[model samples]
Target: MGVTIRPQVGALPVRFDEDGILQVLLITSRRSRKWIIPKGNPMKRLAPHHAAAREAFEEAGAIGEIEGRSRGHYRHRKRKARRQFRCRVAVYVMTVERRVERFPERGERAVRWFTVDDARGAIRNRRLRELIARVAADLASSGRPAAGQPA
Candidate 1:
């Protein structure tokens, strides 16, 4: 049997305004420097969705109401110290309520909001790309804005 890869929970933070315009938030992976949603390994005692929210807060200073059900999940190879880890990341859809100027890992990563299409392109993993595409399609139907749709 192959090695067992643990599952990690993450947040796909979205900014949905009154008009249902959707926006997605992406942060640079501290290790790979690739565009990705806020995510991390499951916390010690927190629930998956709750942990995902914490990641958003620490990574992007995002405070929001996170959905309990995961919108989707994808598999990716995460690079650690000197090895690659095969991990599955379950993503919750977080509706951002407010954004703070400071975060714990503020300097560790560069956070950016992007249109779902742009986010899809920025992602290196095929599964992640498809996930974002699916998410965008679902949200756009509601007249939701793009993740990084400018004001």
Candidate 2:
């Protein structure tokens, strides 16, 4: 029998800096040259939004408040030891508070911030690019403060 595969659900946390500049946290995978948003396997018994927040911390050393709601979905392919696979990821937006450059579980990875436009151009996947564009547009239209602002 062929191995069974299931699509995993994941989230991408995004934030913007002051002056309405869009900034997203990106992680450089040690093995893969792909620069991607921080995301990971779903947590057991944890909601997607909370899981997203946790992943941002673990992957990018980010602490942030979840803003708005989970936005949309995107698909990506993953390669295992000898198999190729595809998974769908649900994206979410969060307002970043702080970023710690160092973390205990930091893998062979480096984290950096990118402008939304740069990020859109950097990622290889077209689906991800579209997702980022849509999310950025939504945030802009919302007119909410980046992180700290008066109501």
Go through the candidates in order and give each one's C-alpha lDDT: 0.82, 0.71
lDDT of 2 at 12: 53
Name model 1 segments beyond 4 Å from true.
17-21, 143-151
Best by TM-score: 1
lDDT of each residue in 29-135, candidate 1, tens digit only: 88669998898899889989899999999999999778777878999887777887889999887878788998899999999887677788888989888987887
118, model 2: CA deviation in Å?
A: 0.4
TM-score between model 2 and native: 0.83
Clashing pairs in 2: none
RMSD of each: 4.8, 3.5
Encode model 2's per-residue lDDT on 11-34: one tens digit a residue. 455565667677777787556869
How does model 1 fare in lDDT? Answer: 0.82
Worst 10 residues of 2 by lDDT: 142-151
